[model samples]
Structure formats: C-alpha cells, structure tokens
Target: MAISIQIDRVSREYGPVKALDDVTLDIRAGEFFTLLGSSGCGKSSLLKLIGGFDRQTSGRVAFDGKDVGNLPANRRPVNTVFQSLALFPHMSVAQNVGYGLRLRGLSGSTLETRISGALDLVELSGFGQRDVNLLSGGQRQRVALARALVMEPGILLLDEPLTGLDERLRQQMRDEFGRLHKRTGATFILVTHNQDEALSLSDRMAVMHRGRIEQVDAPARFFEAPANAFVARFVGIDTLLRPERIVATGNHAEATIAGQTLPVRVEGPADLAASVVAIRPDRLFLAPQGMPPALTLMVVGTTFRGLHRDLKLAFSDGQTLVIAIEADADIGQLSAGQQVSVGLKPDAAVLISSAGLPPA
Candidate 1:
C-alpha cells in the first residue's frame, strides 16, 4: 500500500540550536522523493521525524491524512534502511530477511514464502542459505533491503544506504532501487548528500541548508530555476559574478569584471545591487566574427575531460570561470595565457538571490 506524508512546519531543537526550523513539505503517494543536503543541515533530522524515531519539538507530521506525530516507531507503517545495514552477524541471509516477519508472529510456510519473495525482488535468489558474512557488500545490502521489504511497510526510508558501497556497487544499487520502486509502488524517502545521486534517482527532491528548505522541485526544474544563490553554486553553476560588478538594466544587465563588460539576463526585482549572476558552463560559446563577444576572459588553465574540454578562465580581477567545450570544437588550438571573446545567450545568465527563498 502507498501513503502520502506531510511535514507541517516541523521543528527540532537540541537545547540552544534548532535542527529543523519551521519546515513544511509534502510527499505524494508512491513517489521516490529525496531529501538532499550537506551534513548538519537538518535533512537527517527531518527524516528521523518522519520515521517516528525522533519527535519534533513543534508542528505536525501526518501520514495518509492521519496525525502520526504521537505514533511510536513500532506502530508506524514505515521501515528504515540505515547506512550501517545492521545485519545479524551469525544469521543466514534468509533468517535476517525474515527477522521482522518472525517478530510479528508469522511463521510456517507462509513466512518462508514471503522471505523468498523478498530476496528474489532484490535479485538475490538462491542465496538465502548463505551466511551474511560470506555475502559481498552489494549482496549484504540487498539482504538488508529484503528485510525491510518483507515487512511490507507503506513507506520506506533509506538513510544513506549506498554511502558505504564502492563506486561500481553504488551504481548497481541505484539501478536496483529504481527497479524496486517501480515494482512495489511504495513511497520512498531517501536522504543523501550526493547531488548526482539525488538528481539521478529522485522523482523530486528537497534541497536543505542550515535547517531550512531551500528548494523543492523536479531535478530538471531545480537545475534550471534555482530559487537562490546557494542552489546555483551547489548545482554546478560555474560562473558567478560579484554583485558589485553587476550593473542593472531592466530585464537585462551587464557584468563588468577584469576590465571586460558582458551582457546578462536579469531576474526578479532590480532593487538588489548586490545580487550575483550565475552562468552554467554549457551556456558559454566562443564568439566568431559574425557574433559579438559578451565577455572577454583570459584563459588560465585547461583540462581534458574525455567527452569535453574544461577551460578555466580568469577575469581581470582574478576571479575564475569554468567553461565546458565539446571535445571536437575548434578550441583544439586554444591554450593558456590567451585572451578570448566569449558569448553568453540572453537566457543563459540567471541573477540568483544571495539567500534562499521559502517554499511558495
């Protein structure tokens, strides 16, 4: 069964500091939603509130339209897969997966069948008799997942489950989780600091900062329409012009840096003279004769990144800009210590606010 969850102005305080500050969010039924942020940013605190492991200091948590703030962990129809896996050292994979079922007073062939089905869902069929210690890291992870699934919780919370896995295994587990979500149709709330993982895996995610919800949107929209400056930098926008260098001109603006002034697109109110300009690397182009240059930069460094060439340029003021050029581009002749004319399309430049906005 799938369930929707709501966090209404939830806050968690530890004496003097507040871990979560008047945070509000909604998770749709059967969606794979993620809470993404750096450490001590209240992402984990909010997750704990949802899992019923920790109570909020104020506000409400509701599941499937019922107030669940008072519900104990055992009474909630939710299960959490922790980063540690927490598998039994002496138990076989089968026994570990069936641990919850046995605790719930389920036994006989029905319990065995359920355990087998759970293991098969994670693609670990026929490995039930193997000792957990003998299983590989990925296999053990699958077993841990199997244990959680066997309980058939309405919602599943995964707390950095892949953080301990190697690169290859992490990717494999990502695919496995995607498959499991599609198969089960249960709401999944995942916590992670890996932006790539959050973008690739989630249907929609909430980006948190300093115990506040910075932005909540689909990965594409979050990248394209960052609510503020923090998200712009965190989401891979490489070129940021200091507010002092930005001169407003209605919907468009100009950035003057390193003795070079370039045209930019302005967003929101014009009252902010200290607002910054964020530009994605892919948006920059090498201007030829027909097209005029928007910004001129001195090439400081270059890195060959297989599919593309990463060019590092510096403004006259010593600030840096990174541009991604296609591998086959004419930049083949370009090098460091060279002055080049760069062009930025109107929509490529975004004026992001210096601070995050509350969810609208």
Candidate 2:
C-alpha cells in the first residue's frame, strides 16, 4: 500500500550553492506524482532526500507522519529505481532482481515467491532465467521495477529511467509503467524533465526551477493557467506579447498587434507595462476581419505540421506571430507574403503578469 509524504522546509546545500532551497510539498497516498523541470533544477535532489540516499541540510521529511531524515536507505520504507536500471549484466534477471533479498538474508521458497509475484506484476513472468543483457531496454526497465517492487515499499521512486531508452521503447515502457502503478497501488514519485511524460502519467505534477517549485497542479490546469511567464514558456507557450504593444482596459487589455486592437485578459497583477500576453499556437484560429475580434497579419512563412499548417506572421511593427490553421481550412491560393486575418474567441489569449516572470 501507498503512504503519504510530507517534506517541510527542505534544503540541501553544497557549500554556498543551494541545490534545494526551502522546498516543501505534500504527496498524497497512492497518488502518481511527478517532479518536472529542466536540467540543473533541484528535482533530483528532492528525490534523493525522499529516498534517504542523501541527508537534507535543513528541514524535515516524513513518511506517513513519521520523521525519516536520519533513517538510512535500508531503513526507509521506500525503494528507488535509478536511471541506469542498475541490474547486474552478468546475473540472470531473477538473480539481479533478488540481489536485495539475498543481502537481507532472505532465501529459499519465500524469497522466490516474492520475486515471482513482482515479475508478474511487471508482466515479466517466466523470464526469470533470461540474461539481463539479452532482454530489450523496456524489459530491463521492468526488471529494475520488479526489483524495487519486490521490496513492497510504500513509495516507489523512479529517476528518469526511460531517458536512456529509444523513443519507441520509451513509449512502451511508459505504458507498462502506468499499468504497474495501477497494479501495485503504490505511491509513485517520478522524476523527469520531459513535459509530455509528466503530464500524461502523473495525477498531479510540480514544475520546478532553480531549487524552487513554480507551480503544482493537474496537467490540464498547469497547461491552461500556468503560474507565471517562466512556467508558460517552459510549458511550450509560443507567443510572447511585449508590454509596449498592449494597453490595459478594465479586466482585459487592448493589444495593438498586426495593426489591429484585440482584447486579451491580463492575468496576475495590474501593471500594463510590466504584464505580458501569451496565446497558445493551437488556440489561434484563421478567421475573417468581421469576426468579434480580428487581426490581420502578413504571412512571412508557412510549414506543414501534420494536422495543421504553422503560419509565421508579422505585424506592421515587425513583431512576429504564429498561428495554426487546420489542414482542411480554405487556402486555395494561400502563400507566403499574403495578408490574412485571424481571430479568436475572448478566452483564447492569455495575459501573464511580468512580476512572476524571471528578470531579463
């Protein structure tokens, strides 16, 4: 079964440099939680703290309300699956997975039963005698997972194990990982830098930056309403609205882009000059000027993007904008350098506060 975790005011220091700075979080029982961020972020450091592989410089970490900061790795009710899988190539799959049990002096029928159950849970049953090197990348990952699961830890930690696998194998392992989580009902804390992987798998995710968490929410909420400009950009938001081209008008702002005034909802604080605008590329639709709100942009370039065409447009001020057009849209004579009007519904454009954005 899964157990709840509470990390309060945690910080890890390497000399003067802080890898984790005053970070705190509550991971729910049986929840599939993910720590997502770019490289150099303190996500892995936080994971290490939870696994008891490293000690926190300050603050406390608790499992099911019991403080575990001083506990050794073997004493904690948690097991970690490292990125390298850590399986012994010379050992058989069963032997590699049972290595931990043997270390604890467990053997004979009971030990074999636990290993078999774990293998079945990861759908690697009957592959006990197979060499670790002979199995595929996805299978090797499953073996690693089984090894961790055999311990029956309350929480299972995975540190970007799929990063080393190829794209196809990664997807396969991702599906299997989901299934394994459901099967075992263990609280899983996955550490990954891939946004899509985190969004697709986790019940909720925390986006981290420079040892601090920017936002924590469900995937849809995180994408729809990012906490700040940094989260917005990191989450793959395409358009960046300059404050100079916008004017605040009550709850919304009037953006003068492509020589047309458009309504944009300014998010966060009320400073027009310091606030910004962000519109997702997929949210913008091609429409005529007579629409409720419209902007005419000169098409600078176009690229086919499977289901849609990505049109690069420029305004009179030389500012560029990109919008997506459905493949079936009317474009009999459309070409670069052509002027086209595009409009969106009132809720389409997102205005972000400059206060939350990182300093230039």
Candidate 3:
C-alpha cells in the first residue's frame, strides 16, 4: 500500500526571497500528483522540501501521520529521479540498478534477484549486462526509473524528469511511466512546467504561482472551470475583455464593435459593476453574412498557421479578438481592413473577476 504525503502550511525562504508561501495540500495514496508552474514558481523548492533535500522555513511535512519535517533526504521514504539521469558510465546496467541494494549489504542471489526484478519491471529485463552508454535515451530513462523503484520507496518524486527527451520519446516515456505507476502502485509526485505533461500524466495537479498555490484539481475540472482570471489565462491562450464593454440587458450580454452588438453569455454578478469576460479563440464564430443586431467586427489581419489560420480582428470600439479557423476555410474573401461581424453563443463566454490585468 502507498503512504500519503501531507504538506501543511509549508513556507520556505532563501534569505530575502520567499520561495514558497503557506502551501498546504495532500497527496492521496497511489495518486499521481503534479506541481506545475513556470520557472521560479517554487515548484522545485516544494519538491525538495517533500524529499527532505531542503528544509522549510515554517510548517511541517508529514508522511503517514509522522512529522518528517526534519528528516534527512536519505532517511525519508522517498526517491527522486532528477532531470539528469545520473547513471554511472563505469558500471553495467545491473550494477547501476543494484548499487543501492549492494550498499545496504545485500549480496549473492538476493541482490541479483532484486536487480533482475526491477529491470523486468522497467521492461529492460534482458539488458542488465549491457553498457549504460549503449542504451537509447528512453532506455536510459527507464533505467533511472528502475534504479529508483528498486528501493521500493513509499513515494517517487520526479523533477522535470522528461525535460531532455525528444517529442516522440517523451510521449513514449510518458506512456511507460503511466504503466509503471499502475504496476508499482506507489504514490508519484511530479514537478514540471510543461502543461501538457502535467495534464496527461497527473491524476490531480496544483498550479503554483509566485510561491503560492493558485489552484489544485483534476486536469479536466481545472481546465473547464478555472478558479480565477490568472488561472484561466495561464492555462490556455485567450483574450480578456473589459467588464463595462459587456452591456447586460435581459438574459443576454452584448459587446458592440464596428456598429454591431455581439451577443455573449455571462453568469453570476448580474449586478456586476466591474467584470471581465474570457473567450477562447475557437468560441468565436465567423459567418458569411454579417449579423448587425448581434455583432460587428473588422478584420485587421490574418496569419496562416499550418492547420489553422489565426484571424485578428479589431472592433469599431478598438477592442481586439483572435479567432482560430480551419486553414482551408474560404478566408480569401477576408482581408486586412475588411468589415465583418463575429458571432458567439450567449452561453459560451466565461466571466471572471477583474481584480487583475486582462489576459496577455
């Protein structure tokens, strides 16, 4: 069975810089959790704290109800697969994988059995005697994973573990890791800045920003119902519109551009004095006939983007929106400075609080 890792109000500082601030979360047994953020968001620091590589300035880290806040890295029930594979070129695959067991004084058939089992688990069963240098990139990653799994730690912490692999190799390794997780049944904590990796690999994820957790939820829920404006804009590419520009009348809210009022959807704050609306590029529709009663927009520019063309429009009132359309769409008639109206489903707009800057 896997042990749960609990982080309670953990905060860390490096002299004058606050790396993490009052972060609290729980990783359920056998759960694949990811700490995702851009560079310098303190994800790596938090991972180190969990692994006991770094101490938190305040609060506690507990594993299975035991406060292991002051425990040393090697003494904790966790193993880390770092960005670098850190394999030994001087040793064969078997030796490298069995290094920990040998250090713990296991020898003879016991050590061989353990190493062989781990190798088999990682799908490198017959390659134990091969030189580490001769393996492919994906194979090396598997070897690293096998080395960590050999110890049977309560949890596995991976820090940017897939950063160096090529795209195809990364995908292959991700699938392998998923399969290994199910086989090992150990709690996995992954830290990465790559959004797609987090979405694809983690059962649940926490988005860290500027030393604090912005949001934590399952990948699908987090994407569909973002907590705030920052999360909405950060998770995907979007345009943020002004609150006042959205004139609410009856069940519909409309924004006028190029002498046309485009219908939009909004929820909550029916009496909102200041609100922002976020629209995904794909949500906006381009029509052959202009709907003057609903919307009006002028095509400022369009850029070809392989599978899709990016349409840039500027409203008469000076607001800009982007629409991503099929590359083969008959957009030849749409040119720079052309006048057209963009329509949207009244229920498609996502309203967010304007407590921060518009999406960039």
The reply for model 3, stretches above 4 Å from the true place, is 245-274, 288-294, 345-347, 355-360
RMSD of each: 3.4, 2.5, 3.1
- Candidate 1: segments with Cα more than 4 A from true spot: 243-269, 327-337, 356-360
**Candidate 2 lDDT, 135-240, residue by residue in tens:** 9888889999999989888999999988999999888888877887898899999999998789889999999999999888888876577677788888887666
Give the whole-model CA lDDT for all candidates, comma-separated.
0.85, 0.84, 0.82
Ranking by lDDT: 1, 2, 3
Score every model by TM-score: 0.90, 0.90, 0.88
Query: Which stretches of candidate 2 lie above 4 Å from their native place?
Result: 103-105, 245-259, 289-293, 327-332, 355-360
**Candidate 3 displacement at residue 129 in angstroms:** 2.1
- Cα lDDT, model 1, residue 316: 80
Among these predicted structures, which one has the highest lDDT? 1
Model 3: which ten-residue window has the lowest total lDDT? 265-274
Model 1: what TM-score?
A: 0.90
